[model samples]
Target: MRKIIFLSLILIGLGVLLSFRPDRKPLSFPSSRVLPASKKDLQYKTHSVKQSVVHTLLIPASSRFLVTPTLSPELSSLESFVQKHQAIAAINGGFFDPENRKSTSYVMLQGVWVADPKDNKRLMNNLKLRPYLKKILNRTEFRRYRCGQTVRYDITLHSEPSPTGCQLLDALGGGPRVLPELTSVQEGFVDFAKGKVIRDPLGSSQPNARSAIGITSDGSLLVVMVAQKPEAPSNSGLSLPALADFMKTQGVEKAMNLDGGSSSCFYYKGKTVYGKINQQGNQVRRELFSVLVIR
Candidate 1:
């Protein structure tokens, strides 16, 4: 009888001990050969264009790019955007009205329209007149097609209307195509396209901190941010044409310029990788409306 009672107490004590133990996350074992850390694969380099400085980042093909929209209407800095999304790297995305701090271009998050046109008239007026845009804009069937699972890095430029342009915005839902810049490759480089290197028409000589996105020959996405050093002279950023030339050297077949100048920002691994100095003699870290985050 004593033995039976002792065994029951022992069993109850064991059960109580097991219940008090803390939960643990499953351990991940490396398969066969251990792989190198992902951070080791990311290449960081600095290049000089005359007096200006260019900071380039080469991300491997395995990485994924996502467009993170503002959860609130208020503008937030690049650091806040990265933390909110838990991104490995990020750059400012598409244009936004400074007053309202909302994306001026169409933005879709996870197959849902975060920003869309209200009335048909507004939708029709926002339609891009270029041939490529007209086809998708005029067709009612293609208006609501899902272009991709996430937002594309490229923007549909209402500034320079072209028939052969990104239909991503329309695919999400009808919205304005008014962006200052579009795919730079499609815009064409007179010097580079002609197998020569001359200053581009878009003021390649005027140096300013720049931000751009591109696709490599092997289909890897490239996000670039160029900024002037805080202590460097005022003449310390890449010209648009110089930026294009640099992109060509990087094997980028297609590319686009994002908001540059004071808006240029690059965040990587929980830190601001690159940022420009503003005219106010302060390092610029302006609040962003949207950002392209890497996961």
Candidate 2:
């Protein structure tokens, strides 16, 4: 009888212990992080080819329209391809050859331009971005834009997910306009189930934690993000050759890397969606250039 009573008490104690344990639904950082895979996670098939550009999705020749703007042709080349609030840049920037670092992103909407759109900035100052983005404009949100050393931008407005810095899409047609070793870039944006965009920081490891979604007018409106390269933090993951192959496997015909390390940024319409490539913040980055824009 004593043994039975003791066993019952032990079981009760265990139940209580488990009930109070912390939940591990969405894994946290510095601990065990986990990214939830959705239907969007595709297992694409590919053929053996060592080409820089390969078609992932069959773009209807009829649908693939080029951009040529009436204003700065360099501003946008996706001539009449975009609908309302649409623009495509030429030669998107990246971390490939600009080690000298002479680029930053700012925003131009309507006739006004906003620079350094950080989420936490003050709104009262006209020289500041918070007012134009959050207060005066009543825009939902912003963030410092994030992208891989390879993922370049096309163009879209009010499409920025975060409220801080604006991301310039299609800045320079497809890739770095000058001093580049690798060429070709893809542009588009995706949404994260309407919650926020996911960033697979090249510097963080919380498996399945990497993601990004954007409305890609450049590629028939599809969300795009490169899987976290196993060694990006080490500055060794997802090389140009490797990316070409990986993108090929995933049906990415033309893709490019964006500013990596601290310069790498991503944000949903209202939040800085995920971590960054280098994990080191981009605050003190000098000659530091970023894109801050609005619709």
Error of 1 at 217 (Å): 1.1
> Can you write out model 1's per-residue Cα lDDT over 60-177, one digit (the tens) per residue?
5555444334333587888887787788778876555565565544455654556532222433455442323343232111121223443233333333332343333432211112
Query: How do the predictions measure up, each by TM-score?
Result: 0.58, 0.28
**Predicted candidate 2 versus true structure: per-residue lDDT over 47-110, tens digit per residue:** 2232211112222223422322112212321122222224322111222113322212333323
In order, the Cα lDDT scores of the candidates are 0.56, 0.29
**Residue 261 lDDT in candidate 2:** 38
Residue 151 local lDDT, model 1: 28
Using TM-score as the measure, which candidate wins? 1
